[model samples]
Target: MTPIRHNHSDGDAVLDAVRDCVLAVGVRRTTMTDVARRAGVSRMTLYRRWPDVRSLVGDLMTREWVAAATDAMPERRPGTLTRDLIADGLVAGVAAFRAHPLFHKIVDVDPELLLPYVLDRRGASQEALLALLADVLREGHADGSVRQGHVERQARALLLIVQSFALSLRTMTDADDTELNGDAFLAELRGILERTLTP
Candidate 1:
């Protein structure tokens, strides 16, 4: 897929508008006009860039996912353990998604909007996540910490694992559940990932 180019400030404003609008009124009710008004841009500007709300929202979601991944990326340091880096990155990524106001709002209010990406169709967000994980796994492989395997397959599996945690965490735990709180869950997830990737 070709990346859309926009002025950084304008693109941020547009994405921020979409996030706010989705959180405020749900995806189905968020119109291009609404986004334009919130972004302080005319509808024509949005129309020229994106054909409809779905396309615009797709870009918005991709931007958010990339930002979260980039922010969560681990710093490379000498003697750093690959599993530690993976665990830290996954924890940070999941935390970012959990902390996003629009994320929970979408899950609670308009889950169908996410079904296409979750089901058979792979979205740009998923592709970006796969690429990020692949790069990390490649580094681990070069360091002889990760098992030799298909990098793409490993990356996809990791993406699915993390995505499940990010999107369905509420379904997996309850307020009264003691064993599956955030920290405990992350610890277990880290252990699982460490085992999975170890040579």
Candidate 2:
């Protein structure tokens, strides 16, 4: 059995090192030794805290990504989900996706890194998004801007489209077509929602 090391600061330093390695070499290639060297710790120290790269990656996703998703949600306005989705929220989401180096590198090096977060539909990020959508939908319906009957389904559908686009964009090699025209997507989405959802 491997002996456990109980220094909180060392554990944090090792995780941070792992995150850096992930960005530099990606998840699959980032070994415990690499993280330990980067963190100025021993491999035994890292292994004591996290058994393997898989466990470390899973913790990183759950801790970092979940917090990011939850913290990034814009404040809800009851009658303005469409405006929020089209104008500020969607734009912010796109910008965030573009700016996230770790996310980009993960997909670039190993697309499967995205699988648990995207394809499975049960990741921390997805759950956070669903909760946000539910709140927005409830607000929209309460203010009579969104129709009540199909609120949940429509919200999920809208989220799915955005998620799909994001995933596709990550894998795209052509910048010309791959670049997200935020305004265009939002305009089209708003038009569809207005036509279908307005009473």
Candidate 3:
């Protein structure tokens, strides 16, 4: 992909600038002035697009994440939710969050910022995650890997596990514990799902 340039004509360029500002100075310290400087756009132009930093960051993520999900998520296998969850889905999902400075900034500064992105009432990240889980569960059920029960409930439970794992990054960073034992967590999570959902 072509690196977005610093220009007003390109919305992605502005987002790229704002993302850079967040990375360089963190969320709170980054200001419109910094974004303008990084973007090579006039301050007036930046203000016209976004009244504040939160708004700019919010807009960028809201637009970007769905695309990332569809593009990066693994193809659905026939009957193995656990395999998909462990193999590619979880890794891609976490990698997406780790790669985005906006996610890190929000989680690092205040977990509440995750509310709009992950906890909104509509098709928020949680809902999107549930949909992803439901797809895998459907395949699993078809192939006899998943028990026939309330798929929605099971999907919601699975989504919460993933969401909490991602949100826990804040606490993990605060404790300065960077070594994430992904395998251990996956094993624990899978056990929980199997206990709850298996026939």
Candidate 4:
């Protein structure tokens, strides 16, 4: 039989606990016991929901990352163009993620945790983002703001571009440099998205 999933509040508690534990101990050391203790749930409760720390952490990452992306998206105004919205949203999303404490911690301490999502397969959060992007791209298509194409293809392509910048941008940055910088690359990202989507 399949195990029951956490209800809204209970899931939040568990995921929030997972976040705290991972933030403090890193994914390498965090365990189901740690999450259960932090969440004030029984080990059996956590075990029913998630078999291991990595699975629990995966769910936590989905929750936190999706929330970050939603919060980072600009509220669309009556006159706002979709391409503009997409460009601004992508740039803001990248900045928000880079600044996120959880993201920073994982990247700094448990970088390999992300390798599966990066090199192997799309995570729940990524699949969610792709669906949202496809819908938004459909809107842009209706408005003639986005170039006409297979919506899924366009959405995946856009995600690929943003993912690279959001995930790997730090490797190419030098804060002290004047010519090449994070901000400069972000601007370039904006231009690329705008041009890619603009009809």
Candidate 5:
């Protein structure tokens, strides 16, 4: 695979294609050739850009997850507290992720694809979210609305909490039991985030 000589501008089309492919038939069944055919690009072109299906799917996940996180962020008003914004954003972010079709497809059909990210290493999307979180935490610190601490560390901790709720909350949720349903746990998450960020 000629990994270093591809055009980045073609990423949108490629990502869109891979997203459709994966959604139609989970990552395990998706092939590099399928992505190329869906993207209307040559197989050689795809090979030049991505070594395999997993890498292509990785980029697609990064794109879609970042979009969800960005959309979940509340607009900052003059009197809005930064910590409150963060708390709201974190809760909203988890909700968005849980609602994402791509996330659901991967979790339902290709959960093994996530094991490496969950147990072994952070993915590009996680790093992007962490940077976004750190920047917002810095803003909160500047406004005296968040607890003082290393921004990266705080972001990482918050991410750990978010990941649990976003990825695995359903496993413990009891839709038949109102006390432990998804919404209840989301409320708990919001409370935990607020307490963690309170100065």
Candidate 6:
């Protein structure tokens, strides 16, 4: 499949520059002038598109997150259980977040900027994720694989669980006594989802 592109022409370049800048010096220190210079666009052009670095970073995060979620979606099969499909998608989504080169940088360097999306009420990224999962749950309901319930509620619960796991990785213990590695954690999460969805 052709790769999904979030921005148009120079916008793409600008977001790329923003990503590079954020990774290099963090969100606080990345300047519009620096992004303009890196993107080979005039400062005036950058200003026309974004009023400040925070807005620019918000757009960048949205674009990157949409792309990541799109790429992480699992292929739907006729007889697949709803829980299994959601579990697979969650695993892929979490893996995408984990594998992103800038994820750790943002978490370690500019976590405050990300707190609104993860800690507080729903943000653009969270809304997008909920919509995606809602669609999946709706499909499962149509196919008789999902229980009869409020799809939005199910979607919200799924999103919260997956988001918690993804954002709380740094806080997870790595003690040898606890099996909290990627595979084990995902397996546990999958089982939990299965039980939650079972009717």
Better of 5 and 6 by TM-score: 5
Q: Is candidate 2 or candidate 6 better by TM-score?
A: 6
lDDT of 3 by residue, 122-146 (tens): 4444565567677767766776656
TM-score for each model: 0.90, 0.67, 0.63, 0.93, 0.93, 0.89
Single out the weakest 10-residue window by summed lDDT for candidate 2.
Answer: 1-10
In model 4, which runs have C-alpha deviations exceeding 4 angstroms?
A: 1-8, 179-181
- Residue 80 local lDDT, model 3: 38
Clash totals, every prediction? 0, 0, 0, 0, 0, 0
lDDT of 2 by residue, 1-199 (tens): 0112335676577668878999888999999888878999888877777899978877665555544444455665555454344334544564566456776787778778777666555765566566666766676677676667665676677667666655664354355654364545545644654665564
Instruction: For each candidate in the order shown, give its overall lDDT on alpha carbons.
Output: 0.82, 0.64, 0.63, 0.87, 0.89, 0.80
- Tell me how far the alpha carbon of residue 40 in candidate 1 is from the true structure, in angstroms, after superposition: 1.8
- Residues 1-199, candidate 5, lDDT per residue (tens digit)? 0011224567888899999999999999999889989889999999888999999999989888888888888888789999999999889989999999999999999999999999999999999899889989998999999999999999999999999999999878765776733888899999999999999
lDDT rank order: 5, 4, 1, 6, 2, 3
Model 3: lDDT equals: 0.63
Q: After superposition, how far is residue 63 of candidate 3 from its true place, in Å?
A: 5.0
lDDT of 4: 0.87
How would you encode candidate 6's per-residue C-alpha lDDT over 1-199 as one tens digit per residue? 1234543778888999999999999999999999999999999999997999999998888888878877876776666676678777777788788778778788889889988876666777777777878887886787676676898999998888888778886577476636635667777777777777666
Task: Give stretches of model 1 more than 4 Å off.
Answer: 1-7, 179-181
